[model samples]
Target chain A: MDKGRIFAYLITIIACTLYLLPLYTMVNVSLKSPEDLIWGPVAPARRLYFNSYLQAWEKISEPFFNSIKMTVPATLISTFLGSISGLGFYRAKFKYKDLLLFLIVLGFYVPPQAVLIPLVKFLADIGLYSTIAGLVLTHVAYGMPITTLLFKNYYESIPKEILDSAEVDGASLTTLYRSILLPLSLPGFAVVSIFQFTNIWNEFLFALVLGRGRASQLVTVAIANLKGTTLAAWNVQMAGAVIGAIPVAIFYIFATKLVIKGLMAGAIKG
Target chain B: MARYGNLQIFLFILPATVLVGIFVYAFSAWNVSISLTDWRGLVTSIRFVGLENYLKLINDPIAQKALINTFLLAVTFIPLTMLIGLITAILLCLELKGTSIFRTIFLLPLSFSFVISATMWTWMFSPEQGTINSLLRLLHLDFLCQPWITSTEQSLWCILLVYIWQFSGYVTIIYYSGIRSIPQEHIEAAEIDGASRFNIYRHIIVPQLKGETIGVLTILLFYALRVFDLVYLLTGGGPALSSEVLATYMYRMTFNQNLFAYGASIGTVIFIIALAIMIPFLLLSRRR
Candidate 1:
């Protein structure tokens, strides 16, 4: 290769390696037996061990199911709400329309720290405190801003003429959404669902606060608690972390373009 | 659509509007009220103190440490991530062989939750058996090894490294898209004008990324303001509260110590800071 090309390749290689190092170490350490862990982390694992994975899975199974129960409903409800709202904002003409949409989307920017104090008390007052249902409500509420924005922006791409023509055909709002917009929005739904699913699944703060204790705890909290409870069981800890991450990692790897598109759409337009 | 009347549209959007309005905005206001009180402990009675908590926070050393540490992390984390991300984006834009693979690898870290990354990083920063130190030892560079997460002076920096690792990929994807959106003709025209590749990039491509820079800055600053998970998980704002950011400090005050009013005050401060950072960016973008 030419010198300039070689230099570019060299830098890219080094950057990629830097990015991959932690992941490599996590996987490597998880596979090492306790006896092999006596050697420093730099050394390759002497043998691949599945014991840690089994133990970690056993430890986190309840929380894993709780995460699923929490995440699925949260993701589905948020995405469904976002879709209808996106269409509503898209099709409906009202005074201060842009301002109203802006205000709604502005919810995306509010830090969780801002709402956390009131959230805990409110959930408790509603008698859902420290429960998986409370966590679901929290995620669904917080997930609104981004999910709505994603759907709004996604709907914006569809030609308004579709709605115009549908209206001309005597189609009502629900009919237009069901018969026209929803059909066109399948891909958008997929992208937004994946985005919401991963976000709600990976969320920690709400899970930590509202879903405290073993019964209601989500997987992220479970993994964190695993880390805290285990002193030197790095293998189990790493294994648990990996297991918690597998679903999102698969989406990230296979649907990278969609993920990037979701990110840019949510970020730049907002 | 004529059928899309105000009520109909409102009904469609009401669920989210009401939820977010109650959960985010209303609760935020509630937090302000709580901050104005002297309600500490698990007491049901709230006695209004009217900015006393804020006033006390001005004199509180722990709060000062947290504010300074937050500023330091923001000042260090954002620019460093953006710079490295920009550089990596530029390199990947070279379209070298296996660039897609590199892109995938680079962006993979963004998928990991803070808990997972923190877990991995804590082990990596273990002073005695950490990955970095072990590598240093293997390479016969003992002098380079230092106390990482265990020391007050370096703990914040260690936390910053993990933050960079987790987020720089996000910045990279944004900047990469930004760079890709730049018209090819501009670079081609510069090339035809006898500009060296370095000069073309330095003068044209890099400078054209101003919008991306701003976007990245706003997002990074947002993360900086809301940083709880990683700091809470990794350092627990420990080593004498050296790595304490406002979020962790607020969390510790409220949950751990039950200083409800004081914690709410800290939350109010975070809320205001988030607004201060966001409004200008919003206005600037709106004008654009």
Candidate 2:
């Protein structure tokens, strides 16, 4: 290999290692008991310690389940809505369709700060305030734009001839959707739902403001509360952080390609 | 044919359209009207006050500081992330073995929640019991140890470093994909013309990434403008409000203090800034 290839290799490796330090710190510190803390985060732990994980689990396990209760329903509902909405834009052309499409997509662009106050008020007015159902609704509502956009983009990629031929056979709309588009959309649902899962799982502000009660608190909020103590709590906090992160991290381990596709879908089109 | 105004198509989109209309667009409109009021506290005193809250924000010292901090954070992190991302992309595209693993390692941070990152980064940036200062001491450079997030001078920069750490990987992957999508013939032609690897990158590869650059910059802009979780969690906009940005300030004002009108005003500022950043992206995507 030439000097250039060698230089490139060196730079990439060095950058990757340096970028990984904080994560390495999380895992390393989590595995260390208080007695091992003297090594000061750089040295390997004295032994494999599971105490902190157990301790952290005791505190965060409730919110961990809360996160699941919120995320699973929200992901399923939003991705389902996005599919039908996206397919709406896909199959048929209509007047003001672009305008409506633009409006929905525009929703995805606005900062969450823009709508926070009214959302709180509106949710309370409807009596769903500070509830997991409220969070699920908020996520689904906000999720429409991207989910719709993704499904639209996904459906658009399928050749127009397939749809035309199906229509020519006098197939009804339900048949066209159920028999043809539904089968083709499994991968699309995977990509969209994974995107929504990671996003809602990681979402902070909405949960912070809307899901303030312990009954509805998310793991992100729970983990954040763990961050209050500075030194003595490091081990447990890191463990909580690791546990809270594991759900999406599992996707990274197993379905990295889908994760990448979800991330890049909008970017490439834009 | 699946004709326009087909009852089925309209039915399919109704729920999403209604939800988006009410939650996203209408609430945004309500937020704007609230910004024009004197609404504060629990009781609904939606008295019209024009833009007084907005005008008050102009003289609000904390708001001023937050604006400057947000500007500094954006202007610093976005370009730095882009430059780092571009360089990393180029390096990874050098036909190296195990490049996929490198890509995963680089992009792993993107999968982490901001809260998780906030936790890890806070530990790393803690002044006394932190890894960074610990490393400095282990290097026998104990004198160089500094109060990281605890020091106002270093707090924003600490957040900036973490921001770059979190988002640059995503940018790198985008740029890598952009590089891969660049047609090979251009690079080959440049090589045939005696272009060195450096010259080929400088001349052929980077120039063709205009779309990716636009996309990456806008995405980074969106993140920069809304970067609250890390700063709020790590420093809590602390050490004298030095690292406070618009999002944190907005949250504190609206949620913590119940200054609904004032918070809405700040939210309006955020919305405007978002529109400013988004319109170009919108127009560009439309054109394409």
Candidate 3:
């Protein structure tokens, strides 16, 4: 009601619109006929149309499944590995432990460009090139640093006394991890798994290079290919993008709190 | 009681250590050696060229353009995103009605993959039928509509716009937390000293966000260095290679042109730049 409050509301409205416009346009065009897209991207659809979605889905279904195949294994492997490594770094006492963790985490920041050349060559040499397995390996390897960081930080907040008592109960290393750390890590698992699933599902670079052809192509690359093959069919192209984004977008919208928690945890720890 | 011996700890860490060592560090070293050669195509042969690729890269016009474009994108993008993010954070930090809704909407773009965002933005920036131009025309602001990604002059800027839209929300979250963490006593004391709301923020609030700014800048600089998906998907580094950054350009050289060694050299350049940006930041953060 007051001046400042009114000013804040006005800016909020404008910023929300700015944020949502492209998404609105994409959805609008995606529901329109090709003839309607020619009219412009801003206009709302005059008639409901599902043909573009159907066509896009039909073309992209294989790669969509491919993404799932790649993403599931990659997410599981990375999260599991990250958990163990995170636990290792947290519980282990040694000289240069901080330095070692620092080195591991530093890999998260390496530009994919820096390693693309050798990665491709190495994959070829090992005969994993152009396979979904290779793509999984690539994501798992790259996923290690961040996941480890996340789990390490997560485990750090657990009381040292809990671990000491678990040891007092005569638990060995494996039993402690199994009986104590693993159970305590369930929530961390939820956060990291969702985080890793969303990321691995949405990743493009490894999918592009390691899995190029139809047999191995990822949804992201498939969508790009759809754009190329359907240059003038804006409606269908938008449909394909929407389809490719559906899984992660759903995660973001429904599990926003978890996503935000993971993001903040990662950023703050970094 | 459950504490592992050093060897057990080593075993626990071995999988990640081996994977990262071979896949990340070892591969990086391999890439460096590849850069020093004249390897090309599907040949097993590699001739050691001893910095020839680097020398050529230093003299290459496209590489120079990429360096300049990358520099310009970073210098412009980081500050603008930070400013917008900071302002948004400040507003949302006010805890006004509907602030949560606005926060959700702002962070929504961060969920969309670069591939998806690039696809959507391509339609938004398409000159003939883009949402932006169409909206402008409908509003009788036809003169305001300009060639966006289609023009070499504007393509990079268009990409920059999309990058900001995608990332500013992330920076906002960081700054929002930073703002929230500022001690309440400081603000109350300032207000009691006859400071206006604006001065209270200017003198006490914004200065404390220095740590947040550094974090944001480091992330943004790294993003700038490794930008490929957006540029490649949105513009393909083109309108005559005008929007090319090192990543896309290196991708084109290696994959498209099959100039393996040449592309590796460019990759090394990017690696060095990343190191240059990251090493100091790491040391600084550690000191803090």
TM-score of chain B of 1: 0.96
Runs of candidate 1 with Cα error greater than 4 angstroms are none
Query: What DockQ does model 3 achieve?
Result: 0.70
Per-chain TM-score of candidate 3, chain B: 0.96
Error of 2 at A139 (Å): 0.4
Per-residue lDDT of B127 in model 1: 85
TM-scores of the models, in the order given: 0.97, 0.96, 0.97
Give the DockQ (C-alpha) for candidate 2: 0.69
lDDT of 1 by residue, B1-288 (tens): 365567888888888789888988899999999899988886878788898999999999999999999989988999899988888888778888898888888889889989989988887888899888988898899999989989999999999998898888888888898889999999999999999988988999888988777778767876887888998999899999999999999999998999989999999998898888777777787676
lDDT of 3 by residue, A198-237 (tens): 8898888888999978889999888888775544377888
What are the per-model C-alpha RMSD values against the true structure? 1.5, 1.8, 1.6
DockQ values, each candidate? 0.73, 0.69, 0.70
- Give the per-residue lDDT digits (tens) of candidate 1, residues A54-85: 98999899999999998899889899988988
Candidate-wise lDDT, in order? 0.86, 0.87, 0.87
**Ranking of candidates on DockQ, top first:** 1, 3, 2
Separately for all candidates shown, the number of backbone clashes (residues 3 or more apart, or on different chains) is 0, 0, 1
For model 3 chain B, the run of ten residues with the poorest summed lDDT: B1-10
